[model samples]
Target: MQKLNLSQSLSQKLSPQQIQFIKLLQVPTAELDTRIEEELEINPALEEGKEEETEQSQDDDFEDSYDDDLGRDDHELNLDDYLDDEYSGYKMQGDGNYNSDDDDREIPISSQTSLHEQLITQLNFLKLDDRQKIIGQQLIGSIENDGYIRRDLEAIINDLAFSQNIETDIDELEEILRKIQTFDPAGIAARTLQECLIIQLERKEHPDDPVVKHALLIVQDCFEEFTKKHYSKIQKRLDLDEEGIKDAVNLITRLNPKPGGASDGLVRTQYIIPDFILTNNGGKLEVSLNSKNAPELRISRSYADMFDAYDKSDKKDKKLKDTVTFVKQKLDAAKWFIDAIKQRQNTLLRTMEAILNYQKEFFIDGDETNLRPMILKDIAERIDMDISTVSRVANSKSIQTEFGVYPLKYFFSEGIATDSGEDVSNREVKSVLQGMVDAEDKKRPLSDDKLVKMLNKLGYNIARRTVAKYREQLQIPVARLRKEL
Candidate 1:
């Protein structure tokens, strides 16, 4: 038997307050409004109203009415006093502080019809009977967002029989699935890549065009070889020149590999909200957190009133005990939430301010050459926070500079030492690589080794493998693939 030792270590754990802070830190400005709305919906004690009316009503209702009643009356004092506010105001800033009025884009909340919905809509136009339509609807629902139906025919057959109470043969279901694949988005509802390509080929406007017809034949008979870029075999079989092969390859590339992706209805748009805004003001770099992301948040005045009333109320009433507990819990939560929001705003500002200050030269010049190699640890050390915390802040957050909106992570790069003992950012190296590729002769593409040599001559001692890796990262293919007739 193995002896096991169990020991409880006393380590400082994050309080709920701290957890709430981290959560708030992660929310970007673009989604802050929605998050605020969500909070207002969940916490009834937290109300949203105009600044003036909110203050006056809370003071008159809670302080003047409830506070007096609670202090004077000995009658098993009503706990309602604990729920009234003295004065509360939620100041929604118009220009800065989590709400930039300049950004006119408004995200509509109405749910758009999804890809499945659109498919079902098309299915409705088909001349199928009620039963067939039901089967088609079931099939459409089974197709995933990518528009592929990975489930086997037997599984779909059983689903049709048991779930929908409609018996259907495997062959019948496959036929219906094929019909669905033939819908407007050429390759949608396909069971396999082969099927998708075939469906697209069938829908081609000029199906008899020699290049397309040859490409279709290649897909049908030699998909494996074609995928491996065995262009010689394809050319020999079709008796086509290098130019003809290039055109055939171009035609194949034009076909949608995933037909379902063409329908915007099938995809969810991700909106990026920047946490910081950087602008150049008279040769100085100015940085500010997008205040719109950090709404004017505070403890709901009503909760504070409730706390006051609870403090004044007689402590023995059973009803008042639960209400008091409830008030304390909510007040604690509200306070934590507000504190978290404030901390998040402060942290973001501090981090971004450090970045702007550190990269002031780069921002002012708008040149990659001026970028100093910096990382999350550098910012974390500057701000006196853990590296992980800085990373979390930088991960999804974006900054809107006069140049363009970029992810905060984009500014950070590792340094490489130069011969003169100067550090250079890898970003600068990538920029150089991109420039070289852009200026390289297409007819005689530069190989990774040649590119490495070119960089070495330019005083950057980078290895060939590193050059290849960076080139691949930039989405540039190998020299052979880059070669053009």
Candidate 2:
């Protein structure tokens, strides 16, 4: 059956310009330059640098003359077709303008050879045949960032036989694996945590030292007890006294748990470029965007001149019409990009201003306790924007404060009610919880139940389970795990 139906409904959709604005708004200061560069490469009409003031009046007159000349023909391109309230020329936000001082400053970036490359370089030092080198390379590939190869040798054998066309037995693979485990890191490619620790201990310059010998024995024998903090069990199983066990445990803790992390200096350090900079001048806190966010962008003057030249020429030629259409599209894209960048700057300032005003106390003193319990809705309402818009700014953006650089998300936390009938930030409670753990007797660490009671005594209405959750969030272990010899 064929049928046609119509019903009244309402729906909303984002225009191309709106979509572009949303994407640009979410980009952080660190990535904004790259995004602008991509746009400049793709759209020939969009260019970098400030728009010249003298050219503005000439461009306006050219547009006016072209509009009047082209408006008469139905087939001719109309300049007004691309002109709208949403379309805007190059406009600058004064706060984000590039400062000559900032341009002159040099930001140091740390670089290093990656972990895999270093491992391969070390692999090259081993004397082996071409086939053996290939097998060794395959083994090196299996090492993870943490410097552990959890894959079974049998599985690797199967992989090599199928993919590399090398039929090697587990013995040959184990021979290569043992050599890799002895790499520079001292624990490079161990199969397990125990193996990693023992490998490091065995490689110690003073392996004959009593502490190193006992540490190796404990790691090789009573690893489970050592991990569970069952010091009594480890003492009984290893026949070690308290001081012997303490020294061995201390040595074990000194070993790099993640061997790959020991080579962090050999990895490129990630720098956090803040989107906002907040400074407390005397008693007032001022917030401003990183100068990078406010990029100087404008429509290409050559493109604009080309459009004017084409529009002023004869309109009867089909080739000219096609060229005009293409030029108009590019101009439209350039205008849209400039307009979107302007909107993004406005939105970022608005959202960040709301957040700065809301947490003014925290910024003044750099105290987490001073931070108000804030959510995306609070800032969104204050800025008269949507919650999602606020979230987009907070999630990926960071602010450089007097204390340190912190992600915008760090200031946002859930509220907790106190006995005084006032709301406080959950971060405050976590701070208190961390303080208690730091000052607790390690031999008999405070349990969650004790933590809850202590918090309640201090006028915080918290439960044991809530205390446990906060503890986990702070990366603090249970009372048992926190125990010491």
Which has the greatest lDDT? 2
What tens-digit string does per-residue lDDT give for candidate 1 at 1-485? 99999998888899888888888777767777888777755654454432222222233434553332222222233456444532232323431122344256676686766787788889988899999998898888777767788888788888888888998897788778877877777888888887788788878889889888877887887787677667788778878788777887788878888766734544667777777788788887788878686576544544554556565567787767877777666655655565677788888888888888888888887787899999988998898999988888888798887777888888899886666778899899999999998899987889998998898888787888888888988999988777654
Question: Which candidate tops TM-score?
Answer: 2
Where does candidate 1 stray beyond 4 Å? 1-8, 47-111, 129-138, 151-170, 241-244, 262-271
| Total backbone clashes of candidate 2, pairs 3 or more residues apart or in separate chains | 0
* Candidate 2, lDDT over the whole model: 0.81
Error of 1 at 108 (Å): 3.8
Model 1 TM-score on a 0 to 1 scale: 0.80
User: What's the TM-score of every candidate structure?
Assistant: 0.80, 0.86
lDDT accuracy of residue 82 in candidate 1: 41
Candidate 1 lDDT (Cα, 0 to 1): 0.74
| Model 1 deviation from native, Cα RMSD in Å | 6.7
